[model samples]
Each structure stands twice: as C-alpha cells, then as structure tokens.
Target: MIGLIKNEFMKLLLRKKVLISSIVLGVLCILLCLLISVAYKFTTKEAQIESQQYIIEVFEEQLEEAETEEEKNLAQANLDEAKASLEIIKNTPSEDDPNWRINVEETINILKEQLNGLPNDSGEKEEIRKNLLEYQELLNKDIRPMSEMSPKGINMLGYLIAFLGSLFTAIIVIIISSDTVSSECTPPTLKMLLTRPVKRGKVLASKFITAFATSCIVIIGIEIIASVIMGLIFGFGDPAYPMVAGTDYKITTVNAMIGKEAIAVFNSSYLSTIFSVLLKSLLLQVLYIMAATSFFLMISTLVKSSSASIAISIVLLVSINILKVIPYVKPVLPFLFMTYGNTTTVITGEIKISTLSSLPSPIFVVLIFLAWTIIPYIISHLNFTKKDILV
Candidate 1:
C-alpha cells in the first residue's frame, strides 16, 4: 500500500499537464483581477449619478460664489441663519419649506450647468465619469448599500466572484472527477497495480488523495493569486461603494453607525481580506472536488475506459442545473452534493447575514458535503481491497 502511494505520487508529480494547468490558473487569476478592477470603476460611476448627493464642501463653495453682491450677501446671511435650518431641511424637508427645496434645486442646477459647460467629447465625459466614480473597497469590511438612504445590500461583486469562481471550479471538478478513476481502471497499469502485493483499497485511496491535492493546488492557487493582484491594484480601504444596478444602488459597509470610535473599529487587515476570499473560495472548490473524487474513484473500479468516467462526470455536472429546479427534490436540499459548494460569499462578511442564518451553520454545511466524499470513499476502498481485479 505504501509503495503504491509512492508510485502514484511520483506519477502525479511527473505529469507536465499538472504544471501547465497551474500556470494557466495563475495567468487566469491575473485576468480575473483586471476584470474586477474594471467592475469597481463602473460601479462607482453609476452610484454617483444615482445618488446625486453633493459633499458639504462643494455646497459651501457654491454658497459663497453666487453671481452678484446681493446674491453673495443673501447666501452669507442664509449660511449663518440657516446652518441648522438647512440641515434640518436637508434631512426632513416639509413641502411648505420651499426654501429647502429651492436650495437643493439651485445646487443641482449649478452642478449640471458646470457639467454641460464641459466639451461634448466622449473621451472627456468618460474620463470625468471615471474620476467621479472613485470608491474604496476593503478586503473584509462590512458592505451596505448607500442607495435610497436606507439599509440594504450590494453583494454583487463578492457574489459575482463566488459565482464565476464556482462556475469554472465546477467545470474543472467535472474534468478531474472522472479522470481519477477511469484513467486508472482502463489503462494497462490498472491490472498491474491491483495485482501487486498491495491491497486494492490503498490504490483507490491514492487516487482520491492525489486528485484532491492537485485540485487544491490548482484552484486555491488561482483565486489567491488573482485576489492579491486585484486587491493591490484597486487598493484596499473600505467597501463603502454602492453598486448601481438598473436604477437602484446596493451598499454594504461596516456600521460606523454607532459612534466616533466606530470608524477605527471597522478596519480589516489585508491578510483578513485575502483569507476571507481564500476560505470562501477554498471551501467551495474543496467540497465540490471532494464529491467528484469519491464518486469517480468508485467508478474507476467499475469502468473499463477512463473516457467513460470523464463523460459521466461531465454529464452529472450538467444534470445538476436541471435538478436544482425540480420542486419535489427541493425538500432534499441539504443532502444534495451540489448544495455544499458555495461557501465563499458567505464568508465575505459583506452581506447582512445573521451569524445563525443559514439553513444549517456553515460548519454543518461543510460536514454534510464531507460525508459525500467519506462515505463513498471508504466503500470504494473496501471493495478495492476485497475484490478480485481479473474482471
């Protein structure tokens, strides 16, 4: 058994394809990072347009720059007289308080007038829009949507990362799942391996371990590298930016909602950010590939050609989408192998999730998926050890 594991390890290590796959994953991570950065820029621009909220400094300057001496005097008198009044009006304006409404209208008109005065060049507008859209996205900070001046979420970026990551990962899991077993079963080497002094179970175990390790090294490596490059380029601070989708903005941010000290309380380290992303993504791919490794390792024992395992795994993955929509099967939700996969966005701390909210705790969710691997894996091992390979 020990000798078999060693041989399998050497085989996996020597494969050039593994090395190439790792390299490709790294390059793809860099590309993913660039895409995320672009998304940040687009989100910021759209948020600025929809919010239409001007900073106090800009409003203050406008107050001093009204056209004539009388305009300036009126503005100065209002600034002194209505400091509290305007702010109250800003916060809760009555329809009768036309003064509050007029002030806001004047400011917006001035801003628009300035914007219209700029050249109609597309390049210039794009540049200005991009500049106005600057926002900060931190690694592990709470994110809340700042749209509509209320509480909601803008979980799109984190979810988008998880979704896209989950997608590619699911595809890779399919490819490797069947390959682990079928490749061994169909090859000339399969017979020799089984007939060796070693027990059949060890050989099966080796397949699972090798493939699991390969997948971890590949998928985790890709996400980590991509996140680091992207995080650095976009810079980290706070995920206070709003994502404007269609006509609404979704925001997530740490509740500096309490007091002056809350600002410092919300800060998260770079490693925390990386770790959150890593764990979330790792949790996703691990459970997915683990399920694949187990089922296929069993299939490897049954099939004559590695190609069949590959085909079967791909078919199974595609079938998962169809199964998710079935009403009758929804009751079996937690037990489904596909159910354990996406733990990434759940880990981002960006959403307004309660700690106790998931159908099961994240810990419970992981344990269930793990059973998919362990239960089948042990059975395959026992079958491999006890059964004759001559068939």
Candidate 2:
C-alpha cells in the first residue's frame, strides 16, 4: 500500500499541471503581499484623521435632518462624540505614543456617555455598549491595539487566511482532485495499472491518499512562501497580539424606556493570542482541505470526462458558497462543511449569519467536516470498485 501510494505521489509530482499550479500560486502570493503593503502605506495617522473628519460631517448632517426631539438628541450626542474623538486624534503626538492608553481611556468615557444617551431599545445603544466594553478591556489589560494596517507579516497572513486563502485552496484542490480519477481513465492508465495485480480498491485508495497529501502540501507551501515574503517586506510582528474568541450574539428582551423589547446582545468572552489563533486556523484548514479533496474525488469518479469533472466540481463548490448567503438556505448552512471553510472566522467567533439561531460548536463543525471527508470517499470507493473502467 505504501509503495503504491509513493508511486501515485511520484506521478502527481511529475505532472506539468502541478508544476504550473505551483508557479501560479507563488506568483499570487507575491502579488497579494505587494498589494497589502501598498494598502498599509495609505492607512497612516493622517488618513485616520481624515476618516474621523468624514464621520463628523456625517453626524452633523444627521443632526441637521433630525425631526423628532429624541432623534435630535441622539444625533447631537453622536456628533459630540465624533468631534471629541477627532480632537483626540489631532492632539496625539504619534501613532505609537504611550499616551494611546490615555486616549483609549478617554474614548471609553466618551462611548460610555454616548451609550447613556441612547434610548434603551435603540440598536445603536448595543453597538456603542459593545465598543465601550472592548475599550475598557483593552485599557484594563494595558495591551496596545493592533492596527489592521500594522504592516506585520503575521497580520498579513491573518488577512490572507481570512479573505483569500480558503477560496484559492478550494479552487486548486478541486482542479487537482477532479482530474485524479477521470484523467486516468482517458489514457488507458486505469487498465494499465489494474494489470499490475493491484486490487481496484487499493488503486482507488492510493489515488485518494496522493491527491489529499499533494493538496495539503501545496496549500501549506504557498502559505509558507507568502509568510516569508511578507516577513521580509514587513517584520514578522508580535505573536502576542490579542484576538477575541467565543464571540456570540443572543436575542433577548431588554427593559426599554417605553417597555421591554427584543434586542441582539453581542458578547465576546475568551481571548487568545494571534499565534494561538493562527495555529488553530491552520489545523482547521487542513481538515477543510481533506473534506474538499474527498468530495471532488467523488465527483471525478462519477464523471467520466476529466474536463466535465473539473467543471462540475468547481460549480458545486461555488454554488455552495453562494447558497450560504441566501436567507432561505441559511437554515441548512450549519450542516454544510463550506460554512466552516473560513477557519479563522470560525476560530475568532466572527461567523455572524443572522439566520442562524445559534452558532454551531467547533467540535460539531469538525464532525461535519469529517463526515464530508468520510462519506464522499465511501461513495467514491463503492462506485470505483464496482464500475467497469476498461470500456
């Protein structure tokens, strides 16, 4: 079995498609890093001041258009808070100044004041309250805020994993796996291999193992290359930056000025460092790749033409993602492995589909991925072993 798997791996490595894919992936990593570096340069302290100014303008307009006494009060409060924040930004000596802690405390006080002004049932109240709590926690812990545009390698990696990694990995894995079985059938490779006294089941198993292993290697290799390039461009950055975990929202009745009203209460309790979250995300990504590979293999087994297999697999993967945002289909999203494809979001408790009554536990989502891996392989196994490939 080991020898057969090795042989399959060797064949996969020798393929021109594999070589081309690797080059393309590497180039993509370089391009993405360059793009992020450029974006980081634009997020300067002055840009932040400009953003605050824009917010102040928006609030001023809202205050002007307010018709009711309550609306006017809310808009005035918001305008005042925006101006205060803008003043703080203007007065700060530098982005890295130690006075940031003091500024954050001041911001917390401003948010608390805004929160108090908001009516009990107002949706904005909950948002302000959440920010208030987050700021308070940061001040209490004395942890510096990690800017999204920090130009750090680890931050870049996090952004890539969250935004681009999953989609790229899925497309590459689908292309490779979808061709694994069906491509063999076209070149008399299946007949040639079966004549070597190997059981059909062993042949299929070897192909499955090789595809899964190759996809994993390619994904991890690309990540490493991207990380190294980013690190070289921008320092590796601190691994101890705090990441919020176990964030969730619940709908509950709150006592309003008029009466009780249902509102969504947002909460996040656990905190893990960036390194820890990245580690967990990487592990989850591997599981997702396994499930994706197995599912595509099943498609390859079912479809006789390699091109058709690839097309069908890509369409199915894309369609599943599209379905995720459809309100009518959201109820079934928890049962789909694609819902957990963005492992970073899953780890950081950032999955916020409003249609989901509650988020699935991580363990449960892991089981869903495992089921996808095992069930599809079983289907492929049964079909491949029983079917006639010599025709």
Candidate 3:
C-alpha cells in the first residue's frame, strides 16, 4: 500500500500536465500579489512614501502659514500632532463659509469661559484646559491624514482572483483524476487487472490513493509558482506582509467600513490570510474533484469506454458550476466543496468571527463540507469494489 502511494505520488509529480498546472498557478499567485501590492503602494500612502512625507511637510508649512500663535505652537508638535491635524482635516465639516470659523470661535470661547470660571488651586488645569482647546481647534482643520488601512475594494478584488484560481484548480484536479479508475475499468486494463488476481478491494484502494495523490500534487504545484510570482511582482516588505510565522492572524486598524463611524481596522496580515484563503479556496475544489473522480470511477466500473468518462465528467462540472450561480442557493454556498474556490469572501474579514476562534476559522463549515465529500468518496469506492462492473 505504501509502495502504491509512493508510486502514485511519483506518477503525478512527473506528469507534464500536473507540472505545468502547478507552475501556472504559482505564477498566478505571484502576479496577484504584485498587482495588489502596487495598487496598495499608490492608493494607501505609506509612512515612508514620498507623497506621505511631502503631504506632512506641506501641512507643517500650512500650520506655519496659519501664523496664529497657537498654530505655530502646534508646528512644534510631533508626527502625532501632524497626524491629529490631518485627522481633523479628514473629519472637518465641508462647505465654503466663514460660519465654520464661527463654530470654532464659539467652542474656544466656551472652553475659555469655563476655564476662567474654575478657581484653580494650581495652573495645571488651565494649561490642560488650554491644550484641549488647541486640540479641538486642530480637529476643525482641513488637511487630513492618509487612510491607515488598505482600500476595501482592492483587497476584495484580490480575494476574488484568489477565489477564481481556487475554482479552476478543482476543475483541473478533477479532470486529471477523472480517468484514474474508470479508464482502467473501461477496457483492456480492467480485464487484465482482474486476471492478475489482485484483490478487488486492494485495487479500489490503489485507485483512490492514486487519485488523492494526484490531487495533492496538483495543489502543491499550482500554489508554489503562484505564491512566488506574487511575491516577486509585488516586491516584498510592505505593511500587509507580516514578520511572524503565525497562521490565521488578522490585522486591523481604525478603518471605515460601510458607515461613517470609525471602526477599528482589522487588517488581517497577508501570509496567513492568503494561506487561509487559498486553503479554504482549494477546500471546496478538493471536494468537488473528489466527487468528480469518484463519480467517474463509478461510471468506468459500470461503463465500457473512457470516452463516457469524459462526457460524464463534463456534465458534472457544468451542473455544479451552474448550480452555484443560482441566487437563492448562494447563501448555503459554502456547503459545496467547489465553493471553496471563492477566495474573495473567505479571504476578506467580511464575515463575523468568534472572539473565541481565529479569523477565517470556517472550521465547522469546512468539516461539514468535508463530510459531504468523504461520504461520497467512500460510497463510490465501495460501489466499485463490491458491485460487479457489469460492463
């Protein structure tokens, strides 16, 4: 059995189609990374970016230009001050009017009057009260800070590409595995194997192992080039890329979602996110391919020609892909193993997570879907082994 597994493993690694598929998938991953990274560089102004620094410098000049003694005082404030000022500008009321000035003047007066009314034991309260007023004024300014989080649209797009890759991966793996047992059972191979007096069960197990082994190779080969290509194109060492080896970790900041309220930005790191996205993406693909392979094996056992396997496999693939598109059925979408190919939803932090578990921890859903895949696989194997291949 071990020898069979080893042989199957070697068989797939050497298969030209498998090798090419893996390379292409890897290149795809790298290209995606590069594209996303470049988009991020232009869109999300980083701390070290020239534009970011230039913006800060221009802001400082504007503060100096404001010439009000308070503005000059704030000019000496650190990056935090610039950041705060920028935030104020970001949040400031928009309109062309002097009433904006009135609003500021009113708030300052109220703070001043209140401070004067308070009999201070020490001058500490007055200084703090003054700084608070200054801070408030800064908030009313027009220049805002760069967003700290990556653009939601872009990241979502990246997830989509990842998801698409996952979908195709399943189809590819299934196509490769579809001929495994069914081909052997279809013609000269089947009669020859039976004549060799190999146990029917052993033969079934070998075929199953062979198919599984091939699926694994397909996954590994595709991802290897995809990830590497993404890394090279994107050029490494950015904010999303983390320093840790942690898996399923999420990174967030005070980022805007679909509303005005500033929610904490949970910008999950790239590696774990990508890994999780891919794994989860491939998960459904794995299941679908399994089903495809099993179904074909069953057909091969029952039918007499390899050509029948091709037609049956096509029908299965098309049916599943089409069913996935139905609107009402989309919500229960994750149950379909082929659904794992959707890297987008799985990659994004769109879905709520339990504080008790890690982000992208669709563990329960995956387990259930896995059960769906495995049960059919086992049943198919049993059917092939025990039921006479009447063909």
Candidate 4:
C-alpha cells in the first residue's frame, strides 16, 4: 500500500502539466510582489502629506460654504481637526513610522465615537461605523510594525496567504487532479490498471489520497518558496509578530493562537478558541482544495475527456463565484463550498459580502464541506466501479 502511494506520488510529480502550472504560479507570486512594491512607492510619506494638504483645503471650502449655524459649527470643527491632522502628517518622520499608526488609531477612535452617536436606522452611518471598526482593528493589531509593510516584509506573507496563496492552491490543485481518472480512460491506461487485480475502491482511494497529498505539498511548497524569495528581497522581519484574528469588537493575536492559549480563554466567551478557529480555517482551505480536486475527478469520470473535465470544473467554479457576488444569490452561498474559500474571514464570522446578514459558524462550515467532500467521492466511486472499459 505504501509502495502504491509512493508510485502514485512519483507519477504525479513527473507530470509536465503539474510542473508547468507550478512554475506559472511561482512567477505570478514574484510579479505580485513587484506590483505591491510599486504601489507602496506611490503611497509614500510625501503622497500622504500632499493628501493631508488637500483635505485641509476641502475642509476650508466646507467651512466657507456652511449654510446654517449647526452646519457652520460642524464644518468649523472638521476644519480644525483637518488642520491638526495636517500638522501631524507634516511632522511624521516616514511612511513606516509607528507614530502614523498611532495617529490613525486616534482618528479612527474619534470617528467610531461620532458614528456611534448617529441614528442607527441610517444605513450609511452603519456602514461608516463598520468601516471605521475594521480600520481600528488594523491599527490595534500587534502585528509587524509599519516599517515592515514593504513588499519584502513578512507582512506580505499574510496578504499572500490570504489571497494569492489561496487562489493558486485552488487552481493548481484543480488542474492536476481534474484529469486523474478521466485521462486514464483515453488510451490503454484504464484497462492496464484494472487488469492488475486491484479493487476499484482501493484504486480510487489511492488516487484521491495521492491528489490530496499533492495539494498539501504544493501549498506548503509555495509558502516556503515565497518566504525565501521575499525574504531575500526584503529581509525577513520578526516571525513572532502578532496577527490580529477577529472582528473589531473582539480580537486575539497570532501568538495566542500558536500557543493555543487564546483558545482556552476565548472558547466559552467567543464562538471558538483561537486554536480551533485557525485550525478550522486551515481545515477549510484544505477541504476546499480536496473538494475542488474531487469535483474535477468526478467530472473526469463522467465526461471521459480530460479537457472537458478541466473545462467543466473551471466553468463551475467561475460561475459559482460570479453568483456569490450577486446579492440575490447570497442565500445559496452557505450551501456552496466555493464561498467558503476565504476561511479566515468565515472563521472570524466576518462575511465580506455586505448583502449577507450572517456568516456561518465553524461547525456549519465543517458540515457543508463534509457533504461536499463525500458526495463527489461517491459519484466518482460509483461511476468508476461500475463503468465498462472497452479499450
């Protein structure tokens, strides 16, 4: 059994499709870092000072145009605050200065307080407060200092993991595993394998396990390669920097999650422990990769053409993601495994889509994936076990 797994993995590694896709993914990571670096240059300290000056000008115009006593007073107060903020911006040493974040915290807190006083019935006010809360959480997070936010910093890893990493993992895993069984039917391969006396179930299980193991390896490898390349370019900063993980109202640090201390403290009080939260988030990502792989595998078994299997898988994924963006389709998101791809936000109970009223809990996410995971395998298994091979 171990030998079979090894052979399966070896065959996977030798596939030119896997090799080329991985290379493309790596190049994409490098290009993303370059793009981020260029963007950072544009948003530097000088640009910020210029922005503050513009805000002061806008405030002055508002004060001059005030229509009533109440409006005049508000405009005057805003003008004063903008002037003060300009002074602080002028005095700040650099873009990465810790004082910048401190200044932001003060600004966000004041805005939050002001928004809290507004009528709750106003949708615009609620949205502003929500935005302010997210900003406040970022300011309060004990992660890397502002100085380390460059493209080369460890901070980029967080962004990479959350976005690019997730994307590449899904695409590469889907592409590689999509053809696992389907491609075998095209030539002499399927008959050759079944003629060896292996049970159909075991054969299918080996393929599934092989694909899953390959997914893990590919994801981990991407992380390692990204870290090394980015570290070489930007110099690796502190590894122990805290990653803020929670909604603005309640938050915990990455340090707490690693030691599992956050879990014990927040379990009864919060939805789940930090450890459970992160673990579930990671598990969801893994499940997503597996689910994508199996979906494609099932497609392969049903379609018999690897190209058709890949095309159908891509179309399904893209279509679901498109539907996820449409407001009316939000109710179906909970049932769709594709919507759970952003596991970190899901685990934190912060659904990114504004139209969605509530996010699923960790338990619900697990149940959704469990059904998805089982159904695909059953479809592929039944087809593979019963299908006639004429070649």
TM-score of each: 0.57, 0.80, 0.52, 0.73
Candidate 1 backbone overlaps, count: 11
Query: Lowest lDDT 10-mer window, candidate 2?
Result: 258-267
**TM-score of predicted model 1?**
0.57
| Alpha-carbon lDDT, every model | 0.50, 0.76, 0.50, 0.66
C-alpha lDDT (0 to 100) for residue 157 of candidate 1: 32
Question: Per-residue lDDT of 1-391 in model 4, one digit per residue for the tens?
Answer: 6666787888898899888887887787777777777777766677777888888888889888889999989988988998888776655434365566666666677677777777654434644554454445445554323433366546466555566433566678777788888888777688888878678888888888998878877765675578668778877655543333443222223454342111111111132233345455566777777776777778878887888888887887778767766646866777777777667776555543322533365677778777888999999999998754544
Residue lDDT tens for model 2, 114-170 = 987878656567667655665666666676665676667888777767655557788
Pairs with backbone N, CA or C atoms under 3 Å apart (clashes), candidate 2:
none
Full ranking by TM-score: 2, 4, 1, 3
Summed backbone clashes in each candidate are 11, 0, 25, 0
Worst 10 residues of 3 by lDDT: 259-268
Worst 10-residue lDDT window for candidate 4 reads 260-269
Best lDDT among the predictions, by candidate number? 2
Superposed on all Cα atoms, the candidates' RMSDs to the truth, in angstroms, are 15.4, 6.1, 14.4, 8.6
Error of 4 at 6 (Å): 2.0
Question: Candidate 1 on 1-391: residue-level lDDT in tens?
Answer: 5665677667766766666666765666556555545555444433443333334444467676888988778667655654554344353312223343444344445445555666643223423332222212211232322322211112223433465454556555545545665576555666666677765666677777877766766776565555544446543323444231111112234346621111111112122333345445566566767776777666655555777866766676667656755645544655655654555533443221222122333455567667888887877777666546454
